[model samples]
Target: MKNKKKIILIVIAVMMGIFLISGMLKGKSTVEGLVGDPKGTFVNVGKAVTTDIQTKISATGTVKAEESEIVFAEANTKVETFLVEVGDPVKKGDVLLTYDVETKEGLQRDLEKLDLQMETARIALSQLQAGSKQSIMQVQTEIASIDKNLLDVEDGIRQLETSLVIAQKDLEQVEKTYDVTKTLFDEGLAAEKELDDAEKAVMKTKDQVSSLETQVASSKKNIETITMQKSNAQYNLDLLQNKVQDETKAQNIAMKQNEIASLVLQKESVLEQLDKVEEKVLAPIDGVVSRVGAKEGSFVAPGAELMTIINPEKLVVEAEISPYYAAQLETGLTVKVKYNGSTTVETEGTISMVSPVAVQKAAQDKGAVSTAIPVKVAIDNSQGLKEGLTVDLKVVTSEVKGVVAVPLLATMTDKEDNNYLFVVEAGNTLSKRMVKQGAADNHLVQVSDIEDGDIVVTNPTEALEAGMSVSYMLLEEVGE
Candidate 1:
């Protein structure tokens, strides 16, 4: 109907325009005929359209990636090189940047110095033990060798003494035989040759005894010398043990070991520092590089942002909803997410989760603070959505079937906090009636008092009091 009226108006305007331009028709007469009489004032009106008022919960939020992270430098250093640039896709542990490591050279020098110190300490300990021969094993070996030699000497002395005793007995027997032979020869019953043989034998026996006695005496002296030598060896061993303990050799060795350990610890500390100095920053998550905060060769402090990575394919919408409807909206419910841009884009999603805790959003106009519960929606196909894109959402927290409802603007509150609206009667007179309000969205609301197709003034002004007659322009109102 509106399009038809526009066509008729355009045709009439063309006719009037042609008539005035040709000067053949009187313009004043045409003007007077078009506007002959004045009309009374008319108030614009809207007919309540009978429609299903879905009890939806609406909110505005941002599009966020499920996997996202802001990379920061692990340590304070100058940026050396960026291995990847913005918009480049990368995996976890991929190198994003490297830091300047001039300090690593200094650390290496310190490590080298510590290495030299450790080496010197070890050599010093070795030198302290060199040629000392003070160990118990060494002393024990010396004593044993000396003792064996002494035993050999003593055995020789005993064998010589036995030989001497045998030699002396044989000499006595020969002497007696010689005396018997001499007596027999005097008696003329023995020859002089026998007596001479007996005498020679006796002399030979005496000579053998003399030689054995000399050997026995020499063996005895040797035994005495060997015993003295063994005793001296044992005394030297005991002296070495006492001297070693007095010198605190064991304590000295332990001290040297501790010194080397200290040097080793210092070396390890330097190496750890060097590792940090030459550290390479890696991507924390597998994602595309969305932002590059620092360029190559730029200096950055500790915890400074380097880049941002986000998995664009995995997307979610996070919205702050009123706590009143937060409980009604839970996970797995269908949702309509509208991304506002040059053109509004709407996509279907499911409620992923709803937070139980409330967060302070902002202060209301009446100095009352408002709290909101965080809610997340998972998009089925997030192909066109990107991270951080602001969007509007319509979450179907509830649904009322076959119910009477009206525009939310039609409702008002009295001092008693009762909800009411201006209901237009047949004569265009307004009447106020209390209404039982149910779930409401930004547009329509569920009400028990107002039935379907009821005419209610959406924009009731202060001048529109109870029982006042109104000249309403039907279908829609043009006034603000």
Candidate 2:
């Protein structure tokens, strides 16, 4: 029993020793496994490469024809037949439509009426001119006759005055003789018959003087009447002279001439239309008809819309951009365009125009209004483009070639506002390097102080520090 008990204790002690050895071995194995594993943070890394990069502006645009024309009716007419329909290709000077036969007949009638009106106006103007000249001549003749009558009346007045003077002298001598006879009769030295005869002679001389005076007064009255007649005739002549040079007559002649001119213009216009009636409406440009506004057997007024044509070969893309880019947008900038949601239909283009002003537009999502500037891009190759097709555009504002560049995620900023990049060094250790950033695009940034073939950490966390070790996978190896 003592030997057995001793053997049991020995076995127990041996089991305990085995357990202690196994525990020590297990602990040592765990420590060795941990020591064999990667010792730091895991990260993805990319290489700094030399490449070409561009700063691009993105925009949505619509394809449109560069050249378009709207046709309008030149005169009032009815459509006889439409020679072409919408979407029909037409060449320059091709007949587009025809006018009704009655339209030409109406124009001819209008021309004839205009001719008649013009002829009537010309005749009236001629008559007015001839009458004006004849009236002036008649007034001149009347004035000459009045002047002659005035001269004749003046001569008569002078002659009557001379005769009256002679008769008065005779009367004075007879009165003196009568007085002498009266004295002789009173003294009884002369006969009474002689005194009576002297008195009678004196009375007869007085009557003759009175008659001469009356004749002179009558002649003076005749002179006054003749002078008044001359004045009236001269006034009439002056009126006729003024009328010949008057604005009223000139204005009447001008009115007649203007009326004739207007009638002539109307006649010419009608004749022109009549001449073109057979030729009909012609296309003004080589293009495809896009819209038709008039129908057959429909009457249209002058200046009404007829149709619209667009030249599809000359295609352009129109877009609106934010006004914030107005200063940077310019003509002749290179552009890449795509249409119809296509990826392979991209074509090169150039900016043809940029609006100098901003226009207000409603926002696509919020319905708020904002200002935008209009822009147009001329397609270099329009093989896959069509009118009114929506397109995507990327305008290259700036570009750099053969420069050291890296993924934008590889860069970081510090509390001092300094820029830096964590470059993967030998043995998977980090080396923080200061860099000056230049231009940047959506995914890559142009950087200085970084060499080509350098391995940079694409995503550096805040815990990452300089001289810290890390386990990394190459972006290319990871297929990212």
Candidate with the greatest TM-score versus the true structure: 2
Alpha-carbon TM-score of each model against the true structure: 0.46, 0.58
Error of 1 at 183 (Å): 99
Worst 10 residues of 2 by lDDT: 28-37
Tens-place lDDT digits, model 2, residues 309-380: 999888999999887777789999999998755445889999999998889978786978888899999999
Question: What is the per-residue lDDT of model 1 for residues 1-480, given as tens digits with 9 covering 90 to 100?
Answer: 225434544564565446445432443333332221122112334455545656567788889888889987654468888999988999999988887775466668888889888888987676445524644556578778867877876787778778878888888888999889989999998999999999999989888888878887887787788778777666545544564453565566678889988888877777766666655888888999999999888877657889999999999999888877755878988789888777777798988988878898558577678888988999988877888898888887676667777766666667787878787777667777788888665667777777667877765544557776654334433331
Q: What CA root-mean-square deviation does each model show from the true structure?
A: 33.2, 28.2
The global Cα lDDT (0 to 1) of model 2 is 0.80
The global C-alpha lDDT for each of the candidates, from Candidate 1 onward, is 0.73, 0.80
| Candidate 2 clashes between residue pairs 3 or more apart in a chain or in different chains | none
